[model samples]
Target: MKLNAKGALLHRQLYVLLKEQIVTGRYRAGDLLPTQEALCQQFSISRITVRRALADLGEDSFIQNRQGVGAFVTANIGKTKHGPDFSFIGEMRRALKETTMQLLLLETQRCPAAIAAALGLADHEQALHVVRTRSQADEPVALLDGWIPCRFAKAVTAEALKTKSLHELIAGSFEQLGRVAQEVNAALADPIVAQALNIEINSATLKIDRLVHNREGAPVHYVTVLTAPMRTRLVMEVAADDIDGYNVGRLLHDVQQPKAPRRRQP
Candidate 1:
């Protein structure tokens, strides 16, 4: 396959292309793949590179190679496609059957400086503080800390929080709830957060901060989330147009055709 020079290594690119085809059912189980020589000639790659790609596929359980024969598709790993809705709260709710939320703290307290700024609160202003831990399949996954202005405090209760997600409570109580401004970053877990998630201190974690706004553009809540990287992964699917200059067809075609050989000097 033709490899994109600006992208991953030639072998890696070839592996990904073949993997996609197998996973998408273009190549079914028990179907033998093209010979090594045929693959090399079709992709304009070296035998070593083709072998490496095939080896990786075999290791991943996507294919199996028989001596004196060729590699055959052994398994099909199907992927679940998701749409634009990337609501964290929605994800938690859908997995409620296997997930549990433990409310650690819920009370009115003076908002911290950083959280106060995010919620547009004056210094020392009162805010409702909520801390919780979420677990899936009995493994701790995330630690959530939320701060909402005292105006909405009356609508929240320990019992309500235990049953409903924060977003649910907020939306139910306020008619003006609108968009949420969210930011995600890679951070190291502190001692407290690490202990809560059952991870080692200083381990990598995904930190997400969100500022919920009302229809009138007023900030209503600020939330911080620390999640175990192994247990929590974030996936987003966007349209080709949403990603500037991303041509899916061209990418696939590039890997399907052989690169033209360079002309010799006259």
Candidate 2:
């Protein structure tokens, strides 16, 4: 494996990559990692850099390093399980059938500071923003605020949103919709969100942020989804090898009070 010159982040990047390998069973539990010299030469990095990366892996409960025997994946690194393909698109299609959608707002305008940054738009650049609510059995369950780059705005319309997901419409212009970086946490419903979701102001809610990239890894769409805490639940079928899912499951934190959901540029 080769690593690019990322300066200070190079070590941290290496740490994360190695951690992923272990978590995915590429380097299964009890498997010995390459020696420092071997890793240095393989990655074309310095010996010190390799040492730091390995040290971090050991500290993270992913591996154990012997004095001179090199590093080995921890015996209890993670629990592995088998499962079927739970394609996200398929899940969305199921939701489309189960839940009804109402498009509340759809317009192309100058992007907000946070929205522009998340969608990789320049200063004052325009984007299509959509606000919609999802309901099941006549009960509002989710309020979604989404922003898309102007280039993809053509494929998105008020009517299209009621039928197709944002990702589906946007992918028409690209080879494929690639990876999505998502985060979920506790948040409080704000005035606008509370009213849209038919919940009381300051009510607890679950906030989800998803940044989707094109096949080339350029941001295309960013969305924030808020669900009434009492009416909705986030569920994931996770195994040790599902690194991203496992991490998401472990990171849910309890909050002391309701707070407005914060937007972040990934």
Candidate 3:
């Protein structure tokens, strides 16, 4: 409600606002959009502006308008979240187990300097750069941008990724992955990520920096995961008796599981 239409044209502003709502599941498939009169009141715009916005939505395959009746979200709204040509998502739903993955890019390229260093690659070493989006029930939750040294990239084919998580693939291809150094940080979604996750540009995101090493302690896989902050929560559990490594994490959820109550201090 009350979308600021001063910067851009009012109609275009409404179009983007409504589109974002649809993508975020506010107005789902088969849902009836408000009438022109209602939209006019909500955004303080004229009925003509509302019509223009709705017309643009129609042109973008987001809605089907009728002469007397109002517009309705099309049944194919799932594809509309990204665009019309996203029909391949349906195949991904069936091919992947537990969660669906849309492999956007999979190619071998020379690693970037920072990433190459993380993967322990010398200068000019090529690595497999893989980009994918993970979705649950057709809603994208995370984007995985990863790099793998060419030595182990042979098993990371497009077909192979559809069936396994990147970690699983790394474990299968390479023997005895020794340890993983991972840290979580906060970031903002850029244009590329905003488009991929159907979120607003500069939206808050949870970023994960991950480095995997083999038993010999050579870095093998390097990846960064960007997840929608509102869509996910990270839970880490450590047994009461096993308080070994790092302790920087604060208490989020406290679960008490003990044999009996401890004696009260005098």
- Model 2 regions more than 4 Å off: 1-86, 173-175, 237-266
Using TM-score as the measure, what is the rank order of every candidate, best first?
A: 2, 1, 3
lDDT of 1 by residue, 11-121 (tens): 887887898788767888888889999999998889999999999999989999999999999854544434424554455556565678888999899988888888888
For candidate 3, what is the lDDT?
A: 0.78
The CA lDDT of each predicted structure is 0.78, 0.80, 0.78
lDDT of 2: 0.80
Error of 1 at 40 (Å): 31
Which candidate wins on lDDT?
A: 2
TM-score of each: 0.56, 0.57, 0.55
Name every residue pair that clashes in candidate 3.
none
Candidate 3 residues lying further than 4 Å off, grouped into runs, are: 1-97, 173-175, 239-266
Better of 2 and 3 by lDDT: 2
Candidate 2 per-residue lDDT, tens place, 82-196, comes to 3423666666666777799888889887877877887888987888888889899899989988888988678888777766777778887334887777888788788998898
Query: Which structure is stronger by TM-score: 1 or 2?
Result: 2
Model 2: clashing residue pairs? Answer: none
Q: By descending lDDT, how would the candidates be arranged?
A: 2, 1, 3
